[model samples]
Structures are given as C-alpha cells and as structure tokens.
Target: MSLAVALALGTALALPAVAFADADDSDNLMRKKRFGQNTGTVTTNSNTGGHSQESGSKATTETAVISDGAITPFITADGAAAMQAVADKYAAVVAQGGWPKVPSGKLKKGSTGKGPAALNKRLFMEGYLRAEATEGEYAQVFTSATEDALRRFQRNHGLSVTGVIDGPTLGALNVPADRRLATIKANIPRLAEYSKDIGNRYIVVNIPAQQIEAVNDGKVYSLHNAIVGRPSRPTPVVMTPLTVIRFNPYWNAPASIVEKDIVPRMTSSGASKVMRDMNMKIFNGVGGPEIDPDSVNWRRAVVDNYHFRQEPGGSNAMATAKIEFNSPFGIYLHDTPEPHLFHTGSRFYSSGCVRVDKVAILIDWILQGQDGINSSRIAELAETKERLDKPVTNSPQLRVAYLTSWPTRDGVAAFRSDVYQLDGTGFVVGQPLPVGETQGGKRYVLKPIPRSLEAVDADEAVGFASIFRRSSDRIDASERLPGASSKSTDSLVSLKDPKAKLKAQGRDTGKKKSKAASNGKTRAWTGNRERSASEVMSMPDADGTTAKKPGSKKVASKKAKSGDKSKTAKAKADEKAKTTKSTKVVKKDKTEVAAKKPDAKAVTDKKKALTDATKTASADSKSATQKSNTAKAAKPADCKAGADGKLPAGCKPAAAAKKPPAKPEKTAATPAKTASSTN
Candidate 1:
C-alpha cells in the first residue's frame, strides 16, 4: 500500500467497534429505541439511501485522523508528497457538494437532537466516522465517537482543544469546502519551492500554526510553542543559517523603536525616569559613543539618529539568550521574558522576530558540536546576568514559512486562519452561517492575538558591548564568579562596603590594560554607575581615570615634607641670588625712566621714595626682647605700689620719669628679618 492509503486506513480501523448500546445503562440517551426491533445491520453489501457519495462505498472511503500520532517534518520531500495527496482529496471533496455543516450548539456525549445528527453526518463524510459506527441506531443520538472526532477536527484546524461543539468549533465546521481547497492550492507552490535540498537537519517555523519543529535526521527531534509576528508586522519568509548565540544579550533598540516607541514615552513621561527605570541607555550613533541619557537635550528636538540600547538583565526585552542569523530584514530568534504567552492557542505577538518557548532546548540543539555548551553549561549561562557572545560553528538551518493549511504526519490537512490574509481564502473564527444553512459573501475578520504592546528591542546589536565601551555593558567578561567571597575572590571587595570596590576599580592591569588601550588612550569600562560628586574621591570612570573636584585641597605626600628640610641650604643660596638680580633690575629701570619720560619718571621716583621709607621704618622698629630688658633695668628691686598712685619703689613720680629718651631709631638701611618689605 502507498503511504497515503496506509495513513488513511487509521481512520477506518476506528470504525468497526462502535456498538450503540444494550439498553443496560439507564442514563444513556442512546437507548431511545426498543431493543427487540432490528433496525438493520450495515455491511459491505448492504444498500441504504445516503446523503453524500462516500456513504455508498464501504471500504474505499477513509478520512485522515489529523490528531493521530506525529508525522514527517513539514518541509521534507515525503511531507510534500503527503500534502499533494491531501490536496487531491480536498479537490475531490470540492467536486462533490462538500461536507455538511455541523450545527452550532453545545453537544457532548448523551446529547440527542438535530445538532448531533448533523455533526455525525459531517464527521462521517470526512471519514472521521464509518457508516458502521451509527448502524442500526437512532441517527440523531450523540455518541462518544462524535465527541472524539470533533476534537480531531479542532486540533487539525488550530482551534482550542475543547471537545464539545460550541460557537468556535461549529465555526470551523461550517467553513465552505471550496475555501479550504483554495487554501491548500495557494500553499502548494510554497511547499514545492522549499521541497528541494532542505538539509537533513533544519528548523521549520510554521507562522500560521505558531509552532516550531526542529527536524533532525528528517524527523522532528524537538517541538516548541512559538510566538511569531503579528498581522501588522508579519514574520517574513527567510532561509538562513544560525550564526551566533549570545548569552545574556544586550538588546540594541532599532531605529523604528527609537522613533515609534522611545520617543513617545519620553514625550509623555520625563525622559530621565523612563530610561533609568527601563535600564536603557542611549548611544551617539550605531557603534558610536555611549551617551548618558541624562545628557541628551530632550526638549530641543524629536528622537532621531541615535541608537537606543537596553542593558542586559531580567528587564531586557530579549531576556537571557538571542540567536543571530543573517537576513535582509534584520530578523532573528530569541527568548522572551513573557513566557506565559505560550499557553494561548493563538500566539502571534512579536514585531518581526520569533520568540521561542523553552529556548534553552533550541540553543542546546544548535550548539551541539561546539565545546563547553551542553545542558548544564547552558543553564549556567541562562542564570548569568553578564553579556557574553561567541560564534556558532555548528549552526543549523532555519526556515520560516507561512501556511493556512498544513498536512500533518496523521495524513489530514489542518487549517488555520489567514492571519496575514495571505491566502485570501474564506475561513472564519465564529460560525459563518445559521444552523443547517449555507451562504455567499460571508465576511471573516482576522482578529489579533490579545497581548499588550511590548517595548521592542533592536533585532541586531549596534556593536556596543565590544566597541562602545558602555559602562553598563562592561560586564562582557570578568571571569564571572557566582558571587563574592568564595575561593574565586579576585579582589578584596565587599558588597556592603564600597571602599574595597573603589580600590579595585582603577586597577586595570595585565590583560585588561592591553585590551582597553589603543594609541595611548584607555577605553575600558568599569561596569559601575557613573560616579557622582560624593563618589568622586575614589571611583574611576570608564577611562580608568578619576578627577578631584576643582578647588579641593589634596593632602601632600610625606615624602614632600622630608624633601623640604633637605632643600633648606638650597633656599638660602637662592635668596642671595634673587637679591643680586633685583638690585640690577632697579638700576636698569631707573636709567630707562630717565631716558623715556612717559609717566616713567613719576613711577621711578615714587618707587625709590617708597623703598627708602620702608627701610627707615623697619630699622626703627624695636625688638620685643630689648623693650623687656629696658623696663627691668629701670625698676628698683622689691618695689611696691604707693597709695598715692605714684611710683613708690623707684621714688620717682610717673610725670617726672623721663621716657628713656625715646629709643633712637635703629639702622634705617636694614630690612626686618621676619617681615620682608619690597619696593
């Protein structure tokens, strides 16, 4: 048997065992008819009037059980062959009047009404049920088989897996057969386009399905739930090789985000608060200087021509890991902080990039051959907050494609909403028509998956972590220890005490010094916040340099004090030389003033007169020791004060004691020793 027939027979195999009831259970609604009357048995030769053509044949009619076990990868050659067969089946379905619509009302097991009859007929026409299952029983009765078949239909069509029939389930059921066939026709060319030379190992991202299949050895090795681009910013079709895996990546904000996102937020709230809270930094340009956001003049203009970057941490848009690939659209795959979105059935919530669920698995698969990258090593990297990057030598191929109808390993063609409206086929999320009816020009609106607008990160790094030397990005490499005070302690640093951090901050030696310097300038970052006025006394900047505030005094080194004493002898010699030089300068100035009389004569005469007066005043000033000695000599020994307020001991009146002939002026030409006066 061919692969298609073998696959289709799985549906037929489920047919023979469905016995309606023995009238044993009292609560079963299937016991509506009496047991004695034989309605009739359906066999290969039995003839009964049926609603559809498949109802006539017993063995040839077989439907694809879409929710069956896994099948071949969607991009492989055999998978394409499966799709071709499924398309043929759909075309045959379109040739006939198509399957009947399952009525839109809640129906579970034991439900008996017109709704169940319509549902059973619909399931039977698609080969979900054989004629034997409902044989010799009331046709309107809802059987356990109907619920199971409805679930298969839901899974194939990408609807929520609620087994009972409701609005959404019925909506999928009532879609026109011609429209479904059209969806298959549109994507056949696309499938054929990628059918050849797809490597043995590759990754396929089905955008409409919002699921990723990692095909290894032509089979799915791992499956991941994914969030792709939205309707407005649909993910593009691309074939590229994963080139780089960045651990703890810094998200460089693209220009679109800088204009549409960053600018609007800065306009509403204060720019400073938004940047600091979001842990984002602004750059002068792509691969240019990292500018502090506080330095930007926000009021003067709109946000333009600047590179915005989100620092690596839990707050980053691309949390933890980012996988880089080369594409013209600047698209790549990365892990996200929003892990909860994967739970929803319709997950289309990215700009143009793909966000993978459980991305560590994908990373481990991509880096399989590279050294030091296994499950344990990847976990360590995921927990780390430092940014580190390395090239991927054993990268896998990645293909992102869009399809509204896909044939799975189960041999059934599952359908999805035309989210991007690429196929332009008719498929609605809710019931398109009233019960047991058909219509034309039915409108099917594509609704967006409900998720908040996320702040977008740059698809490509602006080359900041290596070249820009941003302070926030400096943790690119530090021989990262788990934490402080272990055997790995490289410095005497303490978390509570910053002084130790300060001491180690400027000690960029060994490998760091050579790496940070080029052409005699240092561009090494210290990975610390910008130093403030209080921290200026100790902390270093990105250049490994620190500056003291202007006008602040610095304590002189002890060596300078010891040198001053040794220089005392030199000081005396220097004083003598200065005296000689000054006398010559005064004589030359006197001569020049005599020659040129433009206020020079008055200035010279005043200078000379002032010098002479200063000399005379210094000579006349008596020494404090001499004054004390003179007073002692004049006073009589054992002198006592008289009641008459007169000088009793000296036996002379205060008026009669001559004031010792006012001490004669000392030498007028000598200058004072301690206080020097210059003319």
Candidate 2:
C-alpha cells in the first residue's frame, strides 16, 4: 500500500477502541451524558469512512469515548501541528521563560487560545505581566502547573504579581515566531557596540519592549517598566555610569523643551498662574544672554518661548528625586507624581528622562549604601523635607544613562527605540548602519558576544607640580582657597580628590589642556622673557645701540686723554669728550664747534626772518582796524533820517550803525557758505 493508504489504516484500527468503553475504566462502561444517553453495542468499520466494509452498504460514523475527563483523542494529530504553530509565533516569549516564569491567567484552561499565548509572552517581555494563582483542584492539573510557571515568568520579567494573564501577555505571545526571532537576531550585530562591557552594574532599557533591566555581576538584579520619551522626543542611545541620586531635585528647564512645550502654554491666558501653581520658574532666553523670565513680555509671550522650567516641585516632570549622571545625553531616572501610568502596558511617555515603575524599590537597591549613594537615608530625609534645605548625611548618588542596545541572558543582541532621536545615528558616533536595518536606522544590532570594559586607570594622578603652580599663582594674587583654612586634612583637598567627585572633571581638564598646549603659546612663558622685560629699559641711540645716560654712567678719567686728531688739536677734543660724555655727550670741542657753527647760524637766521614777517602782518592788521573805527566815528551823527520824512538815499543814516552787526543766524550759513568764507 502507498504511504497515504498506510496512514488511513492506522486511523481505522484506532477508531474502534474509542467507542468501546468496557475496553478501559469501569466508569466509562456506564456512560450517562448530561446532554445525551449512550446505549448497547456499537460497531463501525473504520478502514475507510467514504466506503462501507460490506459491498453496497453506506459507511457509518465512528463513535468516540468520553470518560475520566479524557476524550479518546486528547488532541488531533493536525491539532498538535496547529499548537506548534502557535508556539512558533511566540518564540521571543518562550525564550524569556529561560529567565522568567509564565504569567498568571496566561495558562488558565479557558484562556488557552492561540492569540492569548503570544500576547502573554509579549506582556512578559515588557515587564507588565500580572499573575494570580489558579483556584481549586484545577491548580493541580498539568495546565495549572503551566500557569504557575507562567506566573514565575511574569515575576522574573519584572511584571506585577497578578495570576491571570492579560492583554499584554496575549500580545507578546502572538508575535509571529519568525518576527520574534528576527528581532533577537537583528540586535545581535550591535552587542559589542552597545557597551564596552555592561560593567558589573549597569542598566539596560529596551525601547521596543519598554522595560529597564538592572544587571549586576552578569545577572539581573532588578527589573522595572520604564516610561520613555514620546515618539517626537525619544530617549537617546549612549553609555554612562551611575554616580549620584539627587533627592528632591530641582528641574533646570532646558531651552528646547521650554520653546516646544512651556512657552505657548504659558501665553494662553491663565498660563502664568498655572505655571506658578506647578512651581515653574520662567526665564527669558531671547532678550539677553542670561535667561531671565521676568524680562520677557509675559503679556504677549507664549508658554513655548523656550525658557520656562518646572522648578523643584511635586508636579514637575523631573520629579522630586533625581538620578544624577554625567552622560552627554543628560538623562536621569526619577519618580513621577503620576504613578498610575505604570499600570498600563505602554509606558513610553516622557520628555527625555526615564520614568521608572517601582522607583522606590529600585531606590532601595541603589541606596543600599554598599557602593553607590545610600538611598534609604535620602528617603527618610525626603519625608521630613528639612534635609535638602540644609546639609544632610546619607545622600544618594545617582547616575542616569542612555543605552539603545544590550545583551540578553543568552548573549543575544537587543535593541530599543531611539526615543529621543538625536541627529547622530551610529555604532559609536560615526559608524551608522544602513537605513531600514536596525531599530534606529543605526547599527546597534546583535553581534559577537561583547567584551569587558577597557582597562582604564582608576588611580588618578594629582599632578602635584601642575597643581602647585596654579595654586602658587592664586596665592601670589592674594586670593585664598574658596573656603576658610582649616586644620582638618580635607581642607587641602581639591578636585584631585578621587574618593568623592566623578573622574569626568579631571579627564575633561586634561583634554582641554591638550588642544590648548598644541599651539605652543599657552605654555611659552620662557619664549617671551626678553620681549616682556623690554619696557623696563631705556630707549636705543643712533647706530642701533642702547645709549647710557649720564645718571647711569660712572665718573672716570680718560687714560687716552683728548682724541688726538694729531696731538695738540686732538688733546682739546679728547678732554672735552671726557667731560661731555658724562652728560650723554653734551660737551662740544672748539674744533668741532667751529666746523658746524656756520650751518647752525644760517638755520637760526632763517627762523628769525619768518618770525619778523609774522609780527609785521599782525601790526598792519591792527592799524587798519583802528583807522576804520575813526572813520565811522566822524560820519555817523549827521547821516540820520530828516524830519521831513526824506532821507539821503546814499548815506542811508549809516543803518543806525547796525549795533556792530548781530551775529548771522545759524540757518543763514550753509556748509558751502562757511567754506567760501574760510577760502
């Protein structure tokens, strides 16, 4: 028989046993159905349902047994294939099971549907599974065992302990198996690029999944659902370490956020008052360099002017608590007033910072005080509200970071959305992946297993000599250290103290010097010594040699005697030089004087002639003015108007002498007229 025929024969033999209840349990023989009754003996040929065992007779339907809560065929052969197909779609969820248990309600008997299984797994991956224990003996069943496993899965994946599977779980389970696998594999390429090494303690945020995983010592320490930035303002991808946790942090409004979200909202009528209610501090970003909110035209300005900030207040997006880090991305973890947002499966909703679910729990871990900030004391202080107002002990250190890709337990690459979508997309900064490749159009995908962080010198050098030079300068300037001198050893410590402050400040200071030193001028004090001292000295003389004045010269007798220009004549010259050189060569000998006298006298005579001509012109002008005045005095009295109303037209009464002519009005004199008078 053909292969198809052999399979049909096997089904035929299996069919009869199902109809005969006496073949198995005693309870099965006395079958009384709630909806129907079973009677007598029943027989049927099963070799072929399409044709009868006896020729010329119609084929009869085979009967199935129902007993002991077991159907004759628990599952059809084809149905088993269908179940595997469902499993394939939720491969990511199943893979997560290696670390997490199955969520509650996910494996309940009535809940076992193809769609639900996939969704349950998806919910598990997102850290949103809520599991509850199944009720009754039903919990003892294998199905119940699976449900319990699902609950463990939910807890492991960072979900709440709700036994029943929900829509989130169902969505996770329903992910197509190929797509799920693809997502994992796609991230593999970016594994090495994600972090130098994830370090002993680091955070991993999966954007697609919207969850935060805290891994330490190659194991998951804690997990939490995170509310990431909105699509328009997605979280960025970067590598940073946690260093501080600022409790009751004040929000310094970033300019872009103020422009996009704060300004317009404020300008809309009652915004200022609302912002005041929200404890926001407004600043001006446009009018001047410093952002002064009061200087802004609040009457005409909108809330979106890019200068508003929600100060340290309960309603602020930055929250009362802050996780301080030094990442260029400037992200931090914090608490939110709106804790209910965590309940929903989707938590991606923030400006750029990460909003943590169960933040208090996470704080309990970071603040354990073993290595990082002691968070417990900070929480206590937060309650009292007095610690932040003054100095308080046990402050938590926070370090916010941005990581787009990371590894799974099995070393598979994982990627998250570039929630803050910074312009740069790449492996580090420049090596971006081809478009439509990874989640960020960047190259953070699964690759070879990542290596550990590179070896960096934890022992920082104090650069004592360099530091001493700097301090000595300040000392010379009479400026003391910013603090009062104390006998305490800590008073002498500075940024060089590595125990408390981050390594970033020192590293940055080092880098800044590198570029500045390259030009060679910043450290070229020795190169300009002579030029700098030049101002303190006297001027040079002819022939380009510096001249010594009489005050600087010492009295000395001339051994050579007067310059001998042939004995006697030279004697007088040499004698005179000796005396005059003492006064910067003021003395002149008779021979030298006779030689230059005629030329000097001629120059003097020319100057005297020029002076005499100037004096003669001055005298002539004065005499002319006096003569004119005398003439005016002789003629003015008789030239007045006649009593008969007739006057000499020629004399014109001297125009009453015109009071020496009033000064011309400024308007009457144009620039051209002034130029003519000057000419």
Write down the TM-score of every candidate: 0.52, 0.38
**Weakest 10 consecutive residues of candidate 2 by summed lDDT:** 17-26
Task: Write model 2 residue lDDT over 315-383, tens digit each, in one string.
Answer: 645444655544333455666656555555555566556776556556555556544445556455455
lDDT of 1 by residue, 446-533 (tens): 2211112221111112122334343333221111112211112234455356655544575432323333232122222222112233
Q: In candidate 1, which residue pairs clash? A: 71-409
Using lDDT, give the best candidate's number.
1
| lDDT values for all models | 0.55, 0.39
Model 1: weakest 10-residue lDDT segment is 46-55
User: Which stretches of model 2 miss by more than 4 angstroms?
Assistant: 1-107, 110-174, 284-295, 298-307, 358-364, 367-376, 386-679
**Cα deviation of 193, candidate 1, in Å:** 2.0
